[model samples]
Target: MNENRHSVIVIVIIIVGVILLSKLFMIQVVDDSFLRRAERNAVQRIIDYPYRGLISDRNSELLVYNNPVFDLMVIPQEFSIKDTAKFCDIFQIEKQKLIERYTAAKKYSWVKPSPLIKQISTTDFAKIQDYLIDYPGLFVMTRSVRAYPDSIAASALGYIAEIIPRQMERDSLHYYNQGDYIGHSGLESYYEKILRGKKGAKYKMVNVRGVDKGSFKNGTLDTASVAGLNLQSTIDMQLQQYGEKLMKGKRGSVVAIEPKTGEILSIISAPVYDPNLLAGAAYSKNYNILLSDTTKPLFIRPIQAKYPPGSIFKVVQSLIGLQWGTLTPNTTYACNKALVACHNHPSPVNLFGAIRNSCNPYYYQAFRQMINQEISSNTYTDTQIGLDKWHEAVEKFGLGHELGVDLPYENSGSVPSSSLYDRIYGKGRWKYSTIYSLSIGQGEMEVTPLQMANLAAIFANKGYYYTPHLIKAINGDPGKIPEEYTTKHDVGVAAHHFDMVQNAMAEALYGTAMRAIIKDITIAGKTGTAQNPHGEDHSVFIAFAPKEDPKIAIAVYVENAGWGGRAAASTASLMIEKYLRGHIERPALEEYVLVGDFGD
Candidate 1:
């Protein structure tokens, strides 16, 4: 009996030992959960972020550059604070804020590191970095914040901010992280993919104290980051700054472009805030301040605001009339009937004289003839046919459409269509007399300042135009001009027709645009006073320099400033002289513009 009992006990003990051994094997060798936990504690993975690309002007002038900044990261699972008071004081944070940030980080991920504080300036980081040792899980990581050296081009250069949750989810490539900086708007947003370079990873061994000891696996597992490609913008910073100065006290926009290449020289919208205002630590604060102001300093008017092309559009009308064969350079129109109000210029003028004097009656009769072309015997069919044909011609000049410039938020100004007129006056019911104001560029046509500048470039190139763009070169290569910008868009008007209109425009430098003349350079320009219901007429001007081999084309607009010659033409003339002559020799004129307040 005793022997049988001892055998039973030994059998039971053997079964228990087998069960224990199998359980140990499963946890130690088969399952990877414990292995992953071990690796997480032993290794620290650091991301090596590449520097964002540098932004410079076509003149090699730095516009947007990066300044060193720091982000505070926390691995919540390992966080230990020996002295809470010292830690809070060093970080310039309240005790409650520290608790909140730490709790949020832990909720995000206990084992992985997350950004606890962002965009600390280098000076502030230097002030507190030595105290970092007191907190075990806290770490300082290097980053860059955008800086503006010259402090111009606030709206053009744009600003960068941290990637939000929405951005991360929408990141189809999974390229950005929670704290990654991204270009939000302007040139920055347009070139984001090219500007943001590849990020790399580095692995380091860590102790219980959470100090990085050395590279894990002798750095074999680490990857190197690549810096972003640099960009050279078409902006001539000097010209841009000068244009900004010219518009210091006014409400307007100025756009200058290189006609041959479609490179933007300068784009200035009045009431601009310093680009630095939206950079670094003060970004949100300054942005809010700028946004709340009634004048809307944050609004980028060149691309944002659309106004009637005013008298400057008569140049387009002249071309349209010439192209349709209803009018010629010598075609005479009797103007003494006073159909539209006159601007005190000689009546019964030729085409060149009509353009020079900005004769209201000439365009009225000329547009009437184009609209009344005999497409069919019926007046309605002919008028609709003629209107549609005229609309197509105007759209060819890039009006009633977005110019597709590099910037964002550009709007296509409305082109009055037959459908629109039908909705208003019913089909076959309206005639040219019903919309005669359209003949003079006043009724329903509107355009952005960018499109107006492109018009100047179109005339500069005669019948063809390169689509306007902001980037001149990328990664030091001028070959980067997009294919869309390089292809010539012919307006289908005869080349010689531009020559005749240009001659008439030159005559305007003596007549309507007398203030635009520079004795050293022969500048061709036109002036327009757009009627404004809110207040005084908005002054408008368009011009190109040196008549022959024209280099720069420009458009200028000043709101509520009566007479296009006074503020708009003067400003354009000064800018043209400055760009061509390298200095404004007419100091008195410059002073007059700088000191004058046309706002009244």
Candidate 2:
């Protein structure tokens, strides 16, 4: 019995030894999980950030370029400082600031690299070369910062800043890191994917001191980061600069579009600061200043500001009437008490004359006829059908909706639908008289400067329009734009109907908008004094130059500017002259535009 017991014990010991050896072999050879974890500390990943895309005007004039910059990175697990004072002096940063940064980086991650200082100056960076090796896990990473050459078009170009936690949560692709930068608004945000190139990384073998030993696996595992694709913007730099100058000291917006392509020529929202104000090391400081300013310079008015389009929308009324067969170029409506008081003009003007004269009663009567017109024998009263037709026709002109411009944060200016009226005035309680003010572009309608400019493009095209977009081409690929941008959006109105209106607008440049006329250039334009319930009226104008073969379509809105005939028209005229003639011949007109305080 003793011998048998000893034999069982010996067999048990042999079985235990075999199990331990097999487990060890599997962990060391078959399962590489432990090996990878061990290599994690030795083989450090160096992120090779690609150069951000370049931006240029349609004419190939460089608007934004990349300048070499440096960010000081630190790994919390490996970070150690021997002399805090020396570090501060070398980087020219406050000691407290360094401590704060170090604490933040440590809190964020222990193993990953975090930026301790961003956008260090060249002189300071050069001085730190000898001292940098002293601090382990502290090194400079080469990157590029955006540099605005012209310092104009701040709102259009937008600004880039560090990505926040919210962005990380929203980014399902998991591309960005904590300290990475991203486009916050404007064209930057619109083309972020196309403009932001793919990020690549290099695996490098490093010593315990964080000193680079050599490339891991001889760089076979490394990836080369490609530079971001360049953007060729539709904006004309000369026109943009001139528009900004014209808009100085005024609270307003100016937008110009190419009639044929719907490409934006120049878009300005004032009072604008230099784009440089939002770039480089002082970005955070200047950003706070801009945020605190009362003027709201950050607002992109061209596609965001919603206001009553005023008499500029009268052209749309005429087109709708023409579509309904309720009005014609010769259609006359007598000026009567049906419409409210208005600025003096010839009474009972024709369709063309009503626009040229801006007669309020004519528009009111015109809108009445349009809404009263029978649709399959449906009466105007106790019915939203006719009014709904009017709404559909108007929306087709790109009003009451975003025109899909290639920029972010566009406001879809409201166009009260028939259902909206059903809610507001009760299903059938509304009538033409109930919304008479709408005929003159007042009541429930609102339009962005971009939408208004698109209206001009529609008229310039005599019915159809391409979606207004800031990017003319991407990566120099002209045909690579969105399908909708290249597609023509026909308003479903006949082209011939626009001729009379164009002729009338041409006549107006010699009449109410006399100041809008350029030397030997017959521009077609309409002036609007959009009523403001709060304060003074807003000056608004929509126009296209050289009436015959239209090139540029523009819209201008000057807040609290009494008459569109002055402020809006003058600005439009100067912009047209500058773009077409390459210079301004009307010095007196330029003086009026620059020194005018119509808004005040």
Candidate 3:
């Protein structure tokens, strides 16, 4: 009986041992998900850096490039504030500020790495890295900071800034994390897709102390980033500089274009800031300064500002009158210093003479006739038909609508229709007399300097113009434009009308713009002194030189400057002389223009 009892007890002890072993196996190996989770919590993830692309001008001049900057990254889950004082000293930040930044970063994300300090110089980064061993959660990361070589085209080139909250929701695949740079305005903003190259990623292994161990899995899934395509603009650097010099201390804008191709040669808006002002670490403060300036130096006036076209608009009126057959090359009206008396000329003055004199009465009669003429026998009544035809002609010329230039935030100046008149003062009740100022390019007719320049181009091309464009080509391909831009648009005016108007414009240089005439250039131009109720008249001029094979067409405006011939006309002349002859022939006129001042 004792032997049987001993055998049974031995078997019972063996069974108990087998049950405990099975439980140990299940906890340690069979269900290992919890163990794996614990291991992942210990290891941190570090980002692999990518270099930003370079931005170059059409001439291959480096407008914007990148410099190596360091960001102090922190993983909140792994973050431990063991050496707070030493960390603050290394980063040259206050302990309180560091704590605040750390707290904010934790609120944003715990797994994702956040920047505690950004835009640190390479030297400072090296110094920090040397002492990184003293801190538990801190790590140094290399990033690209924007650098500008030539700071001339600040508003045109624009600046890159951290992506805002609004942009984050717009596109998440672009993977724009917090503090990522994005184009803010100008060409940079317009071509953001092409300028901002594709992003890349690489998984990195890091230790519990946030020190990078190696590439995760040997970087088998790493992607190499592509650099952005370069851009070549039609802007002439020399001409741009010259135009800016002329506009310095002035509030107006100047736009010059190649008449044949509609390529923008120069676009200058005064009160420009240095591009470097928005670069590096001082951007926020400088941006605030620019925003607070009353002059609005950041404003691009060439396309954004709308001013009365003044006499420059007379060219369009003359063309329309000729096309309607109501005005002839020999048509004439006298400038009698009074509206009624000026309507009747002592003797008939030819159309050329009328334009040369800028005869307001002649245009007044012609404008009235245009409104009274019929488009067809049955289409509409005389006034309605004439107004409809006039609207079509104006629209064909790209007036009363956006010119569709590549620039952002362009203003489409007001071009009042008959319906607009009806809304203002009951249709058919308001006579042409009420809107007579439109004939002189005043009243509700407003246009930007860019539009004025484009009008000059159309006239230069004899009623056909290429769409004005700033970018000539990208990567050696002609820039894409609309079909209407590429197609020829006839103004429905006879070809002879251009000749007659051209002659009158030539004579204008001898009349009001006499001082603007070059010895052998044979230029054609018109001058305008727009009425300004708040201050002195705003001087304006539009012209194209060497009339036969026109090279340059220009439009200039001088705010509060008396007489279009004195300030605006002279400026256009000097610009033409400089562009065509490469030097000013008239030293006296150059000195006069360079020294003459306009009261504010």
Candidate 4:
């Protein structure tokens, strides 16, 4: 009876064991969500940064690039400073400072990783790595910071800064996160789309202590980040460097354009800051210094600052006079102290001589004739119709409107219309004499150095020009230049008219710019000492070299520099000679520019 009872009990135990095993299999295979939750709790996600793109000059010289920088990051939620003394020794920071930094990071976002120490050197990073095992939540993140190989072209290349709150709200793609670098100005900002590239993400697995293990799915789920496309600018680094050197200690701007393609070869604004100042950890301090400087180095004087074109504008006036059939190439005007309306000249002068001498009366006569002839035109009998036609012709030459260059914050200079006169002086109440200075590129006719450079380009091309652009190519193709650039607009003058005006300009270099003459090169140039009501005259010069097939067209404006021919013309000629010949034969000219003593 005892054996039979034992056998029944064993059978019962075996049946219970079978039911338990079956339940275990169901829980393990059919219901896995709880396991996944447990696994997720053990690991955290970390971002892997990719390389950024490079910026190069026309000759493929690197302008801006990225260098690896390590940041001491900490996940506040997982972080614990148990041995504060050892942590302070490892990071080389005071215990209180470390606590303060951690507190600040937590305030920003506790769950998110924040930088405890930024832009630490490689040596510092290596030393920190030795003690990283002791700190559970602290890790080194390999990131890129902008590096400028050459200190030149700081303003043009611009700088990268932390993504701001405003930018975060405006951008929907969420391309950037807090502490991400973004282009702040100039070409860097203009081509941010191509230069920024695309961002990628990875699912990284980490332990319960927030330490990364490896890729979750062996990188199969990872999206590779593409490096930003390289930009090849039309800017010639050598020329740009030389021009910047020439402009040192001066307050002005210089712009050089290739006439055929309208490609900017060089753009220099004086009192520029070193690009290195905006790089690495000391960026904010240096930026504040630059911003507060009295010279206004951050201002892009080429595209933004407006100044009277001065005598350089006479070329355009000559074209208008010829187109209106009021002044011929042979038209002569007396340059006596009374007729010429200047204190210096005392003889009669022809059109060429008038421009050479910069006689005020000649341009005054031409201005009056243009207004009168336009008002009496048979095709446009109405005075307003004729005036509008004249204004339209001027506008076509890229005056009175934005030139649409790729640079940011370009200003459209003012070109007064008859309507403007009516607003100011009640229409017919104002006469040609009231605004005669406009004929000589003064009065309400304000232009930027970029515009003046483009005007030289127009003269070089005779009647047409491509929109002046700094960027030549992005990746491979010449990036999106505007369509309006391709459309040609008549200057309201015959092609032959350019020849006559160009001759006068050529003669002006001989008459007024004798000091700027190159031995073998025939350069056509005009000089202007624009009157500044606020202070002294501003020196300005516009020119193109080798008159026949103009290679480079340039404009130079020097604020408070006495004469256009003295400082402005000399600097422009030196730049041209250096660019064309790859060297300057005249060291004295370079020395003069470098000295920058305009005898205030």
Candidate 5:
């Protein structure tokens, strides 16, 4: 019995030895992962960051470029310094801040590298390089920060910021790191994927002192990073600069488009700061100030702020009426102030005369004809049917919906439909009399400055418009644009109906908008004074130059600037003269706009 038990024990020992030997062979010879893990102390992986794309205007003038910056990285396991005070002094960082950063880094990863300090300028980095040797785990990584040369178009150019924890987790491809920068707004955010190039990797050998010896395998395993593709924007920098200049000290926005191609030549939001303020190391400090300011300089008013279209919308009313066969060019209505108040003008005028004089009663009576078409025996049902039809026609003009501009977060301004009225006033309860405020572009009707600019382009084309976009090309190739920008949208209005309206707008300059007339340029335009219950009226103007074959279409909205004939019209005229003539011949008009002094 004793001999048999000893034999069983011997067999069990032999089986266990065989299993251990097989496992050792599998780990040592079959897989190199364990060996690679062992080499982590001596080897370091480095990220090769690609240069961000450049941005230039239609004139080939540089708008945005990059400047080299440095980030200080730390591996928590190897991070140890005998003199913490001296390190803080070199970096100008507080002792408590340093401790917090180090603790955060340690929590992130003991083995992996994390950012200790970010966006140190080249000059600042140079001052502290010699002292870096005293810290074992700390290393320098080179990257670039955005630089705006001309310092114009702050709202359009946008800004970039570091990737946050949530953003890193959402990175499906695992591209961004903790300290990496990404575009935050405007064109930057809209074209982020196209503007951010692919990243590469480098493996290097490091001594115990953290000194770089050489490439890990003579760069055989290293990959090359590709620079991002450059963007050729549609903006004319000179025109954009001039527009911003004219908007100085004013609270509003300006948008200009090429009537033929739908390319945006200039887009300006006033109360703009130097774009450079948001770049480099000063981003957080300056951003907080801009955010807290009561004036709200950060607001991108062109696509975001919605307001009543006011008298400028009368042009659309006439077109819709003409298309639906509710009114005609020869339709006449008396300038009866009882329907709505109007300035002194000829009474009982035709369409052309009414448009030139901006006769409010004519539009009121014309709108009545449209909404009270006698489609149903019940007055309420007939009003509903007529309003639904009108709403459908208005939607074709790109009102009440996003125009799909190549920018992030564009607001879809409201256009009241029959259903919206139903929600407010209950079904079958409201009619033309309750909603007549829409006739003169008031009440629930709203539009963005960008949409208004597009309206001007539609009128310039006589019945159609292309989608407005800022990007003209990618990597110098204009043919790579999206199909949407190239598509022509017809407003469903007959082309002939525009002739009378165009003729009237040209004559309008000689009447209410006389200040908008430019020398040698026959401009077709309409002025608007949008009423504000909380403050003064907003000045608004829309125009296209050389009424015969329009080249540029524009919209200007100045808040609390009184009559459109003053601030808005004058500014639009100066912009037209500058863009068309290449110089401003009327310095007196330019000075008047700059002064911005309209008596209360």
Candidate 6:
């Protein structure tokens, strides 16, 4: 009985030994959890972020630059701090804030590193970095925040901020991280790819205490970060600042373009905040405040605000009428109030006189002639045929559609078409008289300030215009500018026709827009008081300087201001004189615009 018991005990021991060996084999080689854990403890991946591109004006004036900042990161599984009070004192954060940040990091991933506190400035980081060594699982990553020295062009230059989840999910290449900063509007957003350089990576070795020893593999596997390409924008900083100063306390916008190059010289939206206000720690708070404001300080009025073209649109009508042979230089009409209300201008005026006086009835009759060409026997069909041709002619001038300006969210101002009329007043039911409101730049017509500036540019160019753009050169190379901006877009109007129209516009300055006249400077301009049933009329003006050799083309719009001559014309003339002469000879006029008071 003793021998049988010994044999049974030996068999039991063998069975237990086999099971133990098998389990040891599985733990040692079959499962990868142990290997992964070992690698995690030995190696840490580090991101080498590149410096964002610097931005400069056309004259090499630095507009945007990067300032060094640091982000505190923590690996939640290894994070621990015994002296909470000391930690709070060093980082300038509350104890509850630290706890909340740690909890969030834990929820993100226990092993992965997440930002505990972001965008600590150089001064702040210097004070707290030494104490970070006392806390395990904590290190800093270098980053940059954009700084604007002049603090101008807030809407045009734009601002950058932390990437959103939707943007991250849309990134197919996974280039951006949760903490990455990206451009959110204007030129910054438009040139995001070129401005954000390529990122580099390194494998770092760490001790059991989570102390970074050095680069892994003797830095053989490390990749160097490449600095982003700097931009040479066409913005004239001095002119931009001047325009902004002139637009203060006024609800309007001013846009200026170099007629020869289509390079944007100045773009200003009134009630602009400093670009620095949207950078770094104050972004969210300031953005929320701006968003809630009634006047919409955040609105980019130059390209985004849609306003009725007003009488300035009559210039477009003259060109279209001249092109289609519907009207002539000597075509005459009376200032008849029976057709449309007139402001007591002289009667029996020719095209030049009508443009000078801005007669309502003259354009009213001219549009009737253009829209009733009798192409079809039916009056409605004939009007549609004529209107379709007119619409086609208008679109060629870059109206009724986005001008493709190198900015985000440009408003495509509406142009009334037969299709639009069809949608509104059924297809074969409307006639020329029914839509006579379109004659004097009213009705369904609308335009942005940028478009109006380009219109001025077109008149300056005589028949064609280069697409208006902000970027004159890329990385100091003008040849690198997009071909579309350089290509001439012919508005399909006869070049010689511009001479008559240009002459008439020049005459207008002397007649109606007398406030726009400059000493020894020949300016061709037109003014419009856009009727607004809501309140006072919107003042409008479009002009190009030195009629012989045009240099700058500009458009100005002031909302609820009285006559176009008093406000818009005066403001535009000041901008013109400031740009051409390099100083304002009319300080009184400048002060007048600055005061922003248009009397009743």
Model 1 C-alpha lDDT per residue in residues 6-56, reported as the tens digit of each score: 999999999999999998899899988998898778898899988889999
C-alpha lDDT score of every prediction, in listed order: 0.86, 0.86, 0.75, 0.81, 0.90, 0.88
Clashes of 3: 3
Q: Which numbered prediction scores highest in TM-score against the true structure?
A: 5
Give model 4's TM-score versus the native structure.
Answer: 0.88
Model 6 TM-score, all chains together = 0.92
Cand. 1 Cα-lDDT: 0.86
| Ranking of candidates on TM-score, top first | 5, 2, 6, 1, 4, 3
User: In candidate 2, residue 23 scores what lDDT?
Assistant: 94
Any runs in candidate 6 off by more than 4 Å, and if so which?
1-41, 82-86, 207-209
lDDT of 3 by residue, 1-600 (tens): 999999999999999989999988887989897876865654444444454545554455666677888888887877786677866776799888888899999998776678898878887777767777766666777777677765666666677888899888887575677678888877777777766776666666666654567876687757766666566666666666666677677777788888887777777776777887877667889999999998888888888888888777878988988887777776666554566323333344566767877777777777877786644454224555567667778777778778877678888887777787778887666656777778778888888888888888878878877777666555555544335435555656667679878877888887788878898898888988877877888888989988999999998887788788888888888888888887768888777766757431
* TM-scores for every candidate against the unseen true structure: 0.92, 0.95, 0.85, 0.88, 0.95, 0.92
Per-residue alpha-carbon lDDT of model 2 for 347-371, expressed as tens digits? 7678877888888888887887777
Q: Mark the regions of model 3 whose C-alpha exceeds 4 Å error after superposition.
A: 1-59, 77-99, 121-136, 172-175, 207-211, 340-348, 374-384, 479-490, 583-600
Alpha carbon deviation, residue 335, candidate 5 (Å): 0.6
Please identify model 4 stretches exceeding 4 Å from their true place. 1-45, 82-100, 108-111, 207-213, 336-343, 374-387, 478-492
lDDT of 1 at 445: 83
Q: Estimate, for each residue in 368-421, the C-alpha lDDT of model 4 and write its tens digit.
A: 667655444342234445456567778877888888888888999988887887
Question: Candidate 5's residue-wise lDDT over 1-600, tens digit each?
Answer: 999999999999999999999899999999888988867877878889998899899988999999999989898778887788888899878899789999998898776778888889999998999988887788888989999999998888888898878778878988887677998898887888888888988988876655667999798989988888899899999999999899999989899999889999999988878999999988999999999988789999999998999999999999999998888988999999998888998888998988899889999899989988998989899999888888889989989999999998898998898899999999999988899888889999999999999999999999999999999999999999888999999999999999999999999989987778887799999999888887999999999988888999999999999888889889989998888999999898899898989662
Better of 1 and 6 by TM-score: 6
Question: Model 2: residues >4 Å from true position, as ranges?
Answer: 1-6, 76-83, 108-112, 207-212, 374-383
